[model samples]
Target: MLSIALLGLLVVSAAASPSAIKDRTGRVVHKRTTEIVQLYAYGTNISGLPIYAGSDNLAYLATDDAASNFTAVTWTIDTTGTDAWTVSANTTAATNSSTLSSGSTFYVVTDSSSDDSFAQAGFVSDASDAPSGATTTGIVTYGPYVMILEDTDDKDTYVSEFWATQSDTDGVWTLMWNEAGTAQDNSVPVTLKTTAPVV
Candidate 1:
């Protein structure tokens, strides 16, 4: 499936900020102003690799130079002071799957939902079967960072970063969180790490 390596997903939102103001009676009051600004651009990872939104709507690691022309990768977030949850820019809206897949090692990206931490370990060769609501370009995103399970068989939570190996099927990668080290996929591996899309 296709994804935005150089994602041109720019989000301009009107945010509110309070500024102090003095009243005629010499009393101080807080005033508000709404302005439109660029919230964030989902850029490359610390390894300088661009991120891609898979057809499943989740974020994935992009192969180097896979999307060079793209300048910015923007992701949406709903912040409640301490926490921020990822949102899809083009999907109809949904939440993360509470139940894990039976055989799939990783959760598929879905524009219809909100995912905390997850990555697209596999890619569908066919775009028509994708759940991003449109074409493969519209993908799902997790909050702050893009991550995967700790291991193929673990499936408990996500880890920060590590080297990943490319699957023999091409476009697919085996994911894991190795606080100790990197995981292997057969004899080959696609070295990748998920990080905050903030630029």
Candidate 2:
């Protein structure tokens, strides 16, 4: 009897491939290659005052939603810095560095030339009050989430994309961009989040 039961278990396992599954109506249901994750992006506006004179910098311009689903995420920045702008300490929640996991990556693009009238300096201000623009794209993880930063006075912008994991509480978060420049009136910071839909 024991031998017969073992043989039956093996037979069940061998016949359990994707093609073997059936719905209640006995119709075959194809399996998906990847699991679908959901995320959303929403917010008001992100702009603020400058810390320096003649400065009109933007601070903490980010997506409104805190969750999203994606396959690849990327961030680009157009600044006046001739050298590569540092993305070390600049991030959302003022914590964690701008880094991604193995199946993920990050980037920045700066003008590196001369500062224009509307061009803000550095990555971008982190203040909650300013006018700024930033973009990002990436794969959605289990707890998908992202943040972006931009300068208020600078006409340039930043873009980023990467994969994010899903989670009940927001997972490891990072800032996609940061800028520095002139000051302006105070305002509220805009948060954005995105999620993939189920197919």
lDDT of 1 by residue, 144-197 (tens): 333432224524345334334354544433332233333333422233323433
Would you estimate the TM-scores of all the predictions? 0.29, 0.18
Question: Candidates' lDDT values, in order?
Answer: 0.32, 0.28
Worst 10 residues of 1 by lDDT: 35-44
lDDT of 2 by residue, 116-190 (tens): 222222233332222233222221222234333334463333332211112243321222222233332331222
Q: What is the Cα-based lDDT of residue 111 in candidate 1?
A: 25
Best by lDDT: 1
